[model samples]
Target: MSKALTSFLGENLADLKDKGLYNIIDPVEGPNGPIIKIGGRELINLSSNNYLGLATDSRLKEVGKQAIDQYGVGAGAVRTINGTMDVHLKLEETIATFKGTEAAIAYQSGFNCNMAAISAVMDKHDAILSDELNHASIIDGCRLSKAKIIRFNHSDMEDLRKKAKEAKESGLYNKLMVITDGVFSMDGDIAKLPEIVEIAEEFDLITYVDDAHGSGVLGKGAGTVKHFGLSDKVDFQIGTLSKAIGVVGGYVAGKSDLIDWLKVRSRPFLFSTALTPADVVACTRAIELLMESTELHDRLWENGNYLKAGLKALGFDIGVSETPITPCIIGDEKLTQTFSQRLNEEGVYAKSIVFPTVPKGTGRVRNMPTAAHTKDMLDQAISIYEKVGKELGILA
Candidate 1:
């Protein structure tokens, strides 16, 4: 390694640590489930993104293993070459059906999907009006596309409309697009897609929604687009198989032509190796389960409500979260980190969210309640939260 590169990285790491922005990742001793073991102690897990608990579902594990036995562990080449396997095609078809779209295309992950799809469709001539709170992947994708990115206020309709009008009237760009997360993960607030659709119609702008967090948890597993009944209206519906679906891949569900174009032009699909056989099959099975029953979905909401109620009752500032993604706003970065550490020391495992992720002075401990968590587990976590909050003077 070059000495200059090493020194640069070392300096940055020190700065991050000094600023309380560095994260210490915990290694789970076993499967990430309702209760997780780390540092030899089992704790009620609230930090995982395994929304539906399919990450450790016996059915998915069985199917994945069977798939690995049938097909090798890897997809040999890029999809454009020989990597496009039967399993991949099947997964795409399943995603299309699940998303209620005419066609769908899968990628290795949600970040790659965004990087691939955005640049494939939009160019430097196009301007993208994005939500300010959009995921980091969106920001990178917009940069990669070289599109003129105009950020609108978080879920603010007036700001979006004003920017849309300006972009259209400026005539400096040949085309325009609007992108947003279907559910803002940090805040758990659902995007205002209905109004956004109306705005898009008014401006003839291409609309894209990354529904990574909403899949399997919204619209009976169809996602936020279907939750709002704008399946036909929205142009690009991006989803991750990893989050609520509890597998490993991302996809874009849209009209057949749009998917067809992406399959040919998307760089990640053409350059990167396709998802492995086992991951594809496992994701497909997860989607099938989601479509079959709402048991897990109901449980997830129930647990979210339970936890939210508990935190609110304890006088912790639980932000306005419309979904199961909960954030206990602590305001101070050090306090937030200390709170999360205290929770781990006790019997809970919610992670801290601080600067660069959220605005300064709004540090928080984010909690993700999955379907696997029992009521007793939630109750215990709440009691721990109460204890920690009172001790820290965060609660009265």
Candidate 2:
């Protein structure tokens, strides 16, 4: 490597180290469920996004194993060549049916879906109005689109309307699209999809909702668009097969023509290998389970409410959350990191999110309570929280 390039990287690493911002990766020793084992110690896991606990469900595991038995391990080539297997088509169809859309296309990841879907339609002459606090994937996707990006305040429909009007009034772009996360992961706040739909309709802008965190949590397990009863209004409903689905992949559900266009133009879909047969099968079966019953979703909500109520009763500030995602807002990045370390040391594995991931000094430990967590586990976690809070002088 060149000396200058090496020097620049070294300086950046040194800065991070000096600020105590460089975290060492800690690997989980076993399956990721309501509780996980790390360093041979079990902990009440509040850091995962597996809301429905499908990641450890026996049904999904069985289906995945069967797929492996029948189709082997991997897709041998890119989709455009010969990797589009029967399982892949079934997954796409299942996702479209679940989202109530005409068709769907799958990508290797939710991030890839954003990169593929956004750039496939919008270009330099187009404009995109994105939520100010949308997911990083959405931000990167918007950047890749080469579109004139106009950001609206988080959950502010009026701001979205104003921006949409400005973009349309400019009359310089061929197309205008509005994109947002269906559920804000940090604060666990559900997006104002109904009002966003109204603004999109008023301005005749294309609508997209990335429901990665909402797919198995909202709409009795259908998704955010369905939760708001706007399935037909939103042009693109993007979601992940990871998390609640307990597999891996991302999908975009929309009009048949739009999906067809993506199939042809989305670089990731065309150039990347299709999902493994096992992953596709597991995802399809997970969707089937979701459609068959609302037991998991109901249980997840119950656990979420239980944990949130318990935490609040102990005097810890759980930020504005309308959903199961709860955050213990601990200001100061260093303290937040220290807090997470304390939790882990105390046998609770909640991770701290700091600046760049969140705004400066608003660092927090985000908790994702899932259906698999028992009441006893939650109670224990709350007790641990109380001990930690008092120790840190965050509570009485």
In model 1, the number of clashes is: 0
* Global lDDT of model 1: 0.93
lDDT of 2 by residue, 26-53 (tens): 8999899878999899999998888888
- lDDT for model 2: 0.91
The backbone clash count of each candidate, in order, is: 0, 0
Per-model lDDT? 0.93, 0.91
Question: Could you list the CA RMSD of all candidates, in the order they appear?
Answer: 1.1, 1.0
- What local lDDT score does residue 32 receive in model 2, on the 0 to 100 scale? 95
Off by over 4 Å in 2: none
Maximum-lDDT candidate: 1
Q: Encode model 1's per-residue lDDT on 1-396: one tens digit a residue.
A: 999999999999999888788999999999999899998999999999999899999999999999999998998899988999998899999999999999999999999989999999999999999999999999999999999999999999999999999999999999999999999999999999999999999998999999999988889778899999999999999999889988788999999999999999999998898899999999999998988999999999999999999888888888889999999999988888999999999999999999999999999999999999999999999999999998999988
